[model samples]
Target: MNLKESEPTASASLSRRKFIAGTGLLLAGATLKLQANPLVSGAPLSTLFAEPIIDIHQHTDYMGRTTDQLIAHQRAMGITKTILLPSGRPVNSASTHFGVGNGLQAKATGNTICYGLAKKYPKEFLFGANEVPDVPEAIEEIERYLKLGACVIGESKFGVECDSPEMQKIYELAQAYNVPVLMHWQYGMYNYGLERFHKMLEKYPKVNFIGHSQTWWANIDKNHLDQKVLYPKTKVTPGGLTDQLLSNYENIYGDFGAGSGLGSMTRDEDHARIFIEKHQDKLLFGSDCTDITGHIDNCLGAKIIAEVRKLSPTKKIERKILYHNAKKLFRL
Candidate 1:
């Protein structure tokens, strides 16, 4: 699930019927060849209306990218704005890089980087502060980012469940500041399952938490599931826990960012349609992709967008997922 540089591999074996069922392309107008719409029209009246796209989740480090280069890559992919978090604290104090801090939390200086990006690309970037909850300064760091105008607080990759008490405290702060919290909800393959996600939504109604990666995608089932053993490699049929979460909760949202995350949801047409139709508003488009080459090609974005276009739903609900919902949620 840490897929920092991996390609899509999970659903590569899906058959054509399964693809149709998973993505819903078979139910739509036609296999509309996916293309970048410079001037989009014929959009659904019910979908959220906003400009183009604003990718609310991403990470950027100085592997080989400059600020200008980052912005240019995003623009090419139709991203009007982006939210970035530092990779982590530096391992060596003598190193100029911001230390990777404790395994998952951002250092105080992380807020500085976010604030700086917001200042530089006021129109094209927004700040989301990342902090590890167990860190001594976690509470103070959240307050600092809020004061400095961070619109959101995390794509917090916890090695635990979302409903843990430590996370509850962070959710409390997010609720207080009216900022969204983006967290990685991946638990191998249904590690925490749907019940955990539902509990989080029930307990933290005021806090908006964006779900990402495999665990969230794997849970969307509406009926009795047909068990197929993909044996030691264990793969469940789509649409079990994920569908339930989307249909039941308004505050809970999905961030389709990781490669496995994207592949699981979009590999089949029926699965894609069910996901799009049932949770269009709840799904937020993102790539979880970084690095200079990936940015330039916007590879992840292009691939997922093509998958959505292939579905060709009666409505272009994708616009809302890819852009407007994020704009409204982050107030970007």
Candidate 2:
């Protein structure tokens, strides 16, 4: 979560840790401090690795941001290539509430905007297509972008059941095109039904699935209550459903995007270290951040990259998540 334009906020009495843990939002406007990078001969991450880091998640025309703002934000965060996910349909503010666990709302951007950005800046941007599953024009609109050479087909962030027939149609298109599908798996909110998603996984073996959102990250805990507890700060017990899904399914992957992702890693550093090593091959780096500053103090995306850089067992594995895996998955 934590996209949208609203600044990070919490109750007056809450501490930074509690605020971030509770809201699952990034700690915006904090002071900047550079972390050491062992892989690049101790260079700061912002200035080094200028060619390989790929941001697998981002948006086009997010919060009314201009093209310059978007490009500057990515470049400053050390993102060499960005996967721009445009929204499928307009969101209903009444249904998609601004709760602590849910993502903030923004006006939907069409597939053509993403297509234009990726086309104009081929090296720096890659575009995706999306549409509300239940809408009659869903498959046809999505297929139009796919035919126009869209790399992926989602941020399938609509309020639909995970296994809805319309959603399956999107998966079928993904299978036909042989392209990866990125889904925002917010429990009870976006892409409903996390526990039973394995059926789709089994049914569509050829389509690569990338999972994101608070629910996806919270399920890193085996004991995660099957409800609205989005950012659980408890010590992680191994073999959680998320871990199991990543381990058991070759086509499934995790996106370390947004504050919920950072929260999962921060909840228990020890668990994060072990989890990184175990699923190094399946994890993908994606920062579903909305800030434009691009500084580590303000950018949630850069912070996720920093966490991966600090925790990966090896630089090779780090590079795989940061760039190579997406390159192979998206054929970039």
Candidate 3:
């Protein structure tokens, strides 16, 4: 399909912005506290695993925290390395936190902020370039950052289907640059049409696609029937699409971060254990938690590390999930 042909007309785009603005007011009343604590305790995850961790999924801006606070927080969690993914789209109307901006402006702001952080803390933080796949200058914008050493392309939170022609263009960019494409896949939010996403995997054999968010996690249970596809706490059944996809696709990977990731692991211990063991090499450790506490226990990030350690049959496998796998994939 020709994606450019499907682009919304100017009038339609304007109307959509108006609608978003109207709804944004209702959400603007809520606020996020992005301050950093003076004393951050690093004892939680440090006591759990001796191996240093590499968090492949994280954000520098969305939480409203400064770069210094972000670095301090990662250190507190024993994260030796972190990939800072910036969102290309505006903070959604329903979201109470993150700044309000969209499209090129937002993407530029995130790229500038993350790149600065990466430069300051060269060893600790690495950054990715984010672009809205459906935008007109997406490829050009992404290429500009890739030339400047963006190791990854994404946290793509655009309103497009996973297999849309627009996303294919972005995948081409990733393949050209030899970098992974990280995506946020919520059913109704960014990267819709998850059921047909396998076609993209088949097509882009060289482009690594890291899947995140509720829609991706929902498919972990083969019996997941709800269309809502957000935060399902029921016991997970085997033979889920996520497992099947990981087993079959070498380039596809899982970002185990945020509420969806921790919930998936904690919802069913037996299922999570089996899943982790089965796809140990394909899953990457991440802390999508934006909380400023710096301690893992203070947020779901700590629980995720603890769960992975508990479920991993051996220290070797635990290291693979928590640190080694990300090291290899991102080439840290």
Model 2 ranges with Cα > 4 A deviation: 1-51, 91-104
Please write out the lDDT profile of model 1 over residues 1-332, one tens digit for every residue. Answer: 66744655556535655886767864453334212222233222123224566677665543445665565556656666677754323333311113333333322235577678788767667777756565556778777778878888776654544566667788889999998877655453211334566787788788887777555554554342432211112333455666666677788788877575567555566667766776777877776554344333447765665566566364468677777778778776
Error of 2 at 325 (Å): 1.1
Per-residue alpha-carbon lDDT of candidate 2 for residues 68-92, written as tens digits (9 for 90 to 100):
7887788778787898887765544
Number of the top TM-score candidate: 2
In order, candidate lDDTs are 0.61, 0.80, 0.78
- On TM-score, the stronger of 1 and 2 is 2
10 residues in a row with least lDDT, candidate 1: 224-233
Report, for all candidates in order, the number of backbone clashes: 35, 0, 0
Worst 10 residues of 3 by lDDT: 30-39
lDDT of 3 by residue, 143-231 (tens): 88789899999877766767778889989989999999988777766677878888999999999999888888878999998858588
How far residue 125's Cα lies from its native spot in candidate 1, in Å, is 0.3
lDDT of 1 at 17: 56
Residue 39 Cα positional deviation in candidate 1, in Å, after optimal superposition: 19
